[model samples]
Target: MKEIRVGLIGFGTVGSGLAEVLLAQQERLEKRSGLRIRLAKVADINISEMPPQFGDVALTNDAADLIGDPEIDIVVELIGGIQPAKTFVMNAIAAGKHVVTANKALLSQEGRDIFAAAARHGVEVGFEASVGGGIPVIKALREGLVANKILSIMGIMNGTANYILTRMTDEGIPFDEVLRDAQQQGFAEADPTYDVEGIDTAHKLAILMTMAYGMNITHNDIATEGISRIEPVDIEFAREFGCRIKLLAISRNHGDHVEARVHATMVPERHLLASISGAFNAIHFTGDMVGNVLLYGLGAGKMPTGSAVAADIVDIARNIATGSVGRVPPLSYLPEEISDRKITPMEELSCPYYFRISAVDKPGVLSAVSGILSQHDISIESVIQKGRKQSGPVSIVMRTHTALESSVSKALAEIDALDVVAAPTVKIRILEEDE
Candidate 1:
């Protein structure tokens, strides 16, 4: 048996959980892999309040001290953000240490430079925990599905936003109310901008695009629309029409171009992703060889994320013992092999739409609404008119067939200009059953 010495940075939620799992599963890991995983040292901003589980292990306030430790064979980084995390990883690689990280933001933003440094140092960068927590989607893409050309990837990446949306749909609560509840329950952050504004999902999508389609993505390149604008009324309307509003991170290859985006989507109730509610995560992958495959599990939390990190630790330990650390590229493709295909713009995206028009109940109102669609060359598939809810106007829901988003915007503009219009039209894209 071989012993692998470990250095951990940041004993926050994820870091502490990693320590817990390693301590609890010590016997099983050694029995299964014939390797003893030892925590040689732990580093955090404040080392004075170290947990009792840390036992007699060495502790330090400076992270670089752990990276430079001669006995540490692997360094696990869970201290997220761009600044010192990036600096720490680079310095660890420079010291000839294998690295495992769960920092998706750092990888998505500066993966190219990090991968280049790892190549120069001849070390493996294991980051399975970055994307879908314990779901193993990264491993599936890089190894299991390597035989196929991925057609598309649509994921429910943010558990916080998903929990809020699911509560709004099931409990008939407003967005703000659900968000407040999520925060109180610790499911959401004090500043929920990253989760609700779609920036967090964008970071995950950038990583997925690199592994699935072999493309380098900058966070700015993705067209992101958040769930902040989604309302309970929209959720009710979606349920009435066999659909659910979910914040989806989607990426697809279109000839020489790729479409990568994160937005509030209306997925059909029958779709597998629609059934995934609360703080769980799920992703549907369409591959040429395997067709549609779904990966579902706890997206985040201490134990789930820690399990993923531990798996990587086991892998690196086995490879180290064999003296043959494999060279599986970080992006799963050589830099020269990745294509320079631009992400398709939002205007080019084509999908059906669910439009709810608040207008005065009067003669010729339906004709006026239909006329606007015709002017934009849009086609309406169905229409539902609800009874008057208020004195000012009533809601008229219209379902349209596949149409370009640019045409939908044009039709919406024209509809809002009518004399009968009460407020801005509420429009949500209607995802197809198969898509």
Candidate 2:
């Protein structure tokens, strides 16, 4: 049997998991693929206590040793971030080694240059593990759904944010409390700015937008809003309005522009996406022919991500055994075909909104707010000021019809300036998709 040699970098959680899975499933994978897969080397700055099964594998502190090795057929970079990871991947492709990575941050931000280098070298780069851990959405979009033009891509891509929001909404726990619990359970990082603040989702969304729309879009193009400000009161308000709050990464192609945004969105109770709970991930895509498709699975964690990475490695091995390298362009489409479709600015994005205004218990306050919204062409769909009478301040919840984000922002500022409005107004974008 032809042997495929693999070199793994960054033996952390995901790297360790991949090593363990490969060890346990090597015989089965080889039997199924009719080729042998061997993990020849592992590299990391600080190596941890690995299981005894990997004792024979060469362990090293230097990345150059693995990348420069002529016997290595594939180099898997689990060392995330932009700098060294990008440099390592680019070098591996130059050295004639196929690359597989779970680094969404680097891929979304710097994929254009990396994929271009892979194309130039006539090598392949696999990032099936980059977006949804073990969901296989990448393969679906790049290959399975290749026959159709994808209309939209939306999902709960970040598990940390999803856990936080899911716990908060389901258990009625406060955001801070739920986040702390999630941290204790290893679902969230100590500093979860990327996940909770929506940067992580933006990264994944950028990669999805690239595959779905064939655009060279980056995560920076997304307008991000975190769930940190989401209070239990907001959850209660959503429940009252028959909606659920989820931090959604959404992107779609308009007639002339693409819409990319990440925000705490109001998903209806009846929508399938509204029920995706806990630290799980789900991607819903609308293709021209398929209409709608939803993928759900663990979006993060060692085993799930390892499964995704291993699948990519095996796919690459199969491609190598068939002598068809670079068979699929790095981003699913041909390198020459990736377009530079523009992303619509946040100001131009239009959607229904749920707003909570904390104001003094005074008459005519609703009228004043309505006047400002009407001036901006925003019409109120409904309002609820029930049971807030005897208080120093009251939160009046309101829902608006579809309106441009810029107009809503301006109207919100005007509403916030009123003396009757005691505190800053809160706004959550409503998900108004048809069934």
* Best candidate, lDDT: 2
Candidate topping TM-score: 2
Q: Predicted candidate 1: what Cα RMSD to the true structure?
A: 1.8
lDDT tens digits, residues 147-252, model 2? 8888899899999999998888879899889888888989998998999999999999999988888888898888888989899999999998889899898888
Candidate 1 Cα outliers beyond 4 Å, as residue runs? 360-366, 417-422
**What lDDT score belongs to each candidate, Candidate 1 first?**
0.89, 0.90
lDDT of 1 by residue, 1-435 (tens): 678999999898999899999999999999988999987789997658667767767889989889999999999999999989999999999999999999999999998898889888888899999988889988888888989899999989989999999999889999999999999999999999989999999999998898888887877789888888788878888888899999999989876899998888899988889999999999889999999999999999999999999988988898898887755676778766876678898899899998989899998999989988998989999899988866789889988989998899888988999999999998777779868
Q: List the residue pairs that clash in candidate 2.
A: none
Question: What's the true lDDT of residue 127 in model 2?
Answer: 94
Give candidate 1's error at residue 421 in angstroms: 3.9
Candidate 2 yields a Cα-based lDDT of 0.90
TM-scores, all candidates, are 0.95, 0.97
lDDT for predicted candidate 1 compared with the true structure: 0.89
